[model samples]
Target chain A: MIKLNSNLMIHQYFCLMIRYLKKQNFWFVFTPYFWLVLFFFIPLALIFKISISVSEWGMPPYRDLFSLSEEGFKIDSTLSNYLFIFSDPFYIRSYLNSLSLAFTSTILCLVIGYPIAFYVAKSHANIRIILLVLLIIPFWTSFLLRVYAWKVLLQGSGIINSILIHLGFITEPISMLHNHYAVILGVVYTYLPFMILPLYGYLVKFDLNLIDAANDLGAKPVNTFLKVILPLSLPGIIAGSMLVFIPVVGEFVIPEMLGGSDKLYFGKIIWDEFFVNRDWPVASALAMSGIVILVFPIVIFQLMYAKYNFKNE
Target chain B: MQNTILRMNKLFFKIFTLTIGFSFLYFPILTLIAYSFNDNKRVMVWKGFSFRWYKELFQNEQILEAFYTSIKIASLSATFATIMGVMIGFSLTRISKIPARPFFIFLSSSPLVMPEIILGLSLLLFFISSNHIIGFPSSKGQLTVLISHITFSVAFVAVIIQSRLSSYDKNIEEAAQDLGTIPNMIFWKITAPVILPSIISGWLLAFTLSLDDLVVASFTTGPGANTLPIVVFSKVRLGLSPEVNALSAIIMLIVVLAAISVYFINRSHIKK
Candidate 1:
């Protein structure tokens, strides 16, 4: 009787375990899947819907895309917000300004960052760890404060001016607080780490033997670098560029804090459209345009990168 | 002679590059720290060294409250993001029959690269519509900000956890299963221990992101939800403040200390 009871108990346990696993599989996948779709994907889709909706003076600041009315099943959507954005020179100027800002900053960061990353990678192992930690400390610090530090330094009575005056480089303090130059300086200063980090990642993994081999084969230093090092680190260059470029294009705080009214960028335009102008549709349209402008090149780059890796291997 | 000249040139270039790079990186920060002790109200003018601003920072209730709120939200958001991130990471890597794997990948990864302003705007719109439709979250405050932070932070943590998961050998897990350990037991006893470091780091990353965020919090925040960055931004938006400098100095000290501790802990682990 005891043996029979134990066999029955084991059978029941197996059945319960199988059922639990089946439920676990479903719930495990569905939980996060549901949360992301509801929170992230839906919100993005909402941007498209709002971007196309007709603008009006109201609480929500736009007409409903689909509404129930006396007229059965009406859809009230228009692309006028996008049309308005494309039509205005103000909007066009903002987009161009942002693109140029992003491009200039990315190039500047690359120029300044590449050598630093390369040297850090080539440093002795002990020195490399300390250097990397030093690099990261600033990165982990509050970005706003770092930008504010620049603002303080550039003031009329700030240290930079005082030093310049004492050195007899200038007799009077110059205005340097708010301008396009300040904006670019702030962007490049903040985004330099974003460029350096990825470059260092790739460069640190690179073998030194290849360079020696190139030299043994009678290649000059510049030729070895251009042919072997540069091409091999192309992925890092692209990665670093993407990191700096995509965010710089939509930068709001640095511009708001440092930039003057003489220049306006896409981020500011989108912000003003929503908060200052209370034009929700127009703001959504601007954001949608930003997404398209940013994501398209990135998608193409990713595909090309994958193909390049496959061919190289 | 040629080799000596080339070696000298290389050494000079390296030194020059390092000097310029580090100075550019650290000078502004050093300036801020130095000025925090200035006696003058004007941040740029250095009257003398004093702790007046630091004293004022402590007594200031507005900043103190904002700091508290920031910490509360960051910890909560980081905790929730880590849990959900682990789920996503586990599901994606271990499970073979996930529904719509491509769409899932897109949802989890796109937030990593999306601009903060866009994410902020989208979430703000989402909350507005969701409230209108369902009459939930009746107000936008800490809750809204927490939700927004978690939604974005989940992707970061998921990436960390996923990379850690994929890199580790799976034979140990299979061996455990073959030895009569159930799936749940194997995960708890084996996988969890292996990925604990990633989980902790992921939590820290999410916490830092939440605390450092300004744009998203600005959009989603309502009355009584002012984060540290928002308060600091407002104080310094039109002008500078000495108290803010003091705050910056304090924050830098804390971050450096935390980083040192983390490095030491990692080194000790490596030694073991």
Candidate 2:
């Protein structure tokens, strides 16, 4: 009788707890909030702290920002890391190169991906889904593998050179493996789907009668594209460009594998600073500035846009 | 006659654009697949067609181990990320009184735009500091990599699940409640069944993101936990290797087949 009474009390307590939790909807918010706070926000705060610390040759490779000196609690910090990154031509030039690389690749992908997306979107509705599937299948395969494929094709004795030589276009195997052009080609090849998919998303929904109506109203093919299609697809173009541009700015793998030593890239420089030079402060400084220069502006823009829409409503 | 000529020109343009665009995408992949069967050790030379590289890949223990490790890590990371994502999505869509809602929104979305290299660096630094102060995660390896993958992957899954939940019909739940079904029972029976497909897709999306990660994995991985991309990257960076080509071809085939099967299943579902 005593054991049964205790069990009944425990069940009642558990039911009460469940009722309280449901009333507040606590589980849904608390679980993800706890994880994001620990892993995401705290890590970002830690990076900010380290970015200001002085570089030292200890095991962890940087002096503590807060320390207990003989006099009392003291803080040791330096701005030389940021200063060095800004004042040095090498670092500034690499940042420029990365920006330009991202710009060129974005344009290249837009020019090439636009037509494919338009045509695929305009294909027979019955086959449109199959075409879309085909497009996405290649994207799902190993990204490293697709880039590696280019390595094989661009090598001096690879298939491109073999075909060129067989056609008697050149007498010797031209060295084509490592260069800026090779890196650009590799980037364009890999990021093409990023461009195409968004364009397709917008284009597939478009009504074909608009094109016909434009033609009937005496708009020429070129004018129709300029006035109708391009303007309508502007959102997709911007979306696709942002997707490609932001990541490509910090691209490491393609540049490392395909680019020659003639030029340095922003990603490579930061990597070299941390691993090769073992300068933790410089690396952290570089990352901090990257967030400021590349990521912060876009975030601000998004917030402004959202506020504007909310106010309008 | 002029109208006929114009019509011919349109047809020609469409066909030409498709051929050129598609050829650019497929030419490199085809060449890579072709060379994987070569008999020669040197990648540049084409001696003959053979299965020598495939045999070599099976014998190599390092690549095989990395592949298995990647599968395990991806599965675990995806599962955890999916659970968290579902909870976040459910909260944001169904509940209106979440505390710190704006902060939660910012936390989930910011990682989408953050660069991979910077994300990788910050997480590694955080792990090191936490280890020094708390004396946990004594060394970075599989666990560290898993944690990093889940952090980034949760953003992607959450976005997908959020869209799915927001678009779903809420009247079904209301109707169930009107029929005198308890709120808890209605959620389990109706809400879960409706969102189950989205949950599955979120899991798969998370799986691929974790599997394909290289930069983040490199930062967090230690002595014993080399991933497939890391192994393949190290080999390919130095130059080409025949075994890697074989591995690429096999993976490509598997992916294409899987994608096709998924397409058919989805088509059948739509028809039904």
Best lDDT goes to which candidate?
Answer: 1
Model 2 over residues B34-127: C-alpha lDDT tens digits? Answer: 9999999898798999999999999999999999999999999999999999887777667655544555667776776677888888899899
Give all TM-scores, in the order shown: 0.93, 0.91
Can you give the DockQ of every candidate in the order shown?
A: 0.45, 0.45
lDDT (C-alpha, whole model) for all candidates: 0.89, 0.85
- Give the alpha carbon lDDT tens digit for every residue of A158-178 in model 1: 999999999999999998989
Interface RMSD of each: 4.8, 4.4
- Tens-place lDDT per residue, model 1, B1-272, is 99999999999999999999999999999999999999999888779999999999999999999999999999999999999999988876776545445556666767767888998999999999999989877999999999999999998898788878877887899999999999989999999999998999999989998999999999999999999999999999999999999999999999899889878877787788
**Which 10 consecutive residues of model 2 chain B have the lowest summed lDDT?**
B95-104
Model 2: lDDT of residue B40: 95
Top candidate by TM-score? 1
Residue range with the least summed lDDT across 10 consecutive positions in model 2 chain A: A304-313
* Kept native contacts, fraction for each prediction: 0.60, 0.59
Model 1 TM-score? Answer: 0.93
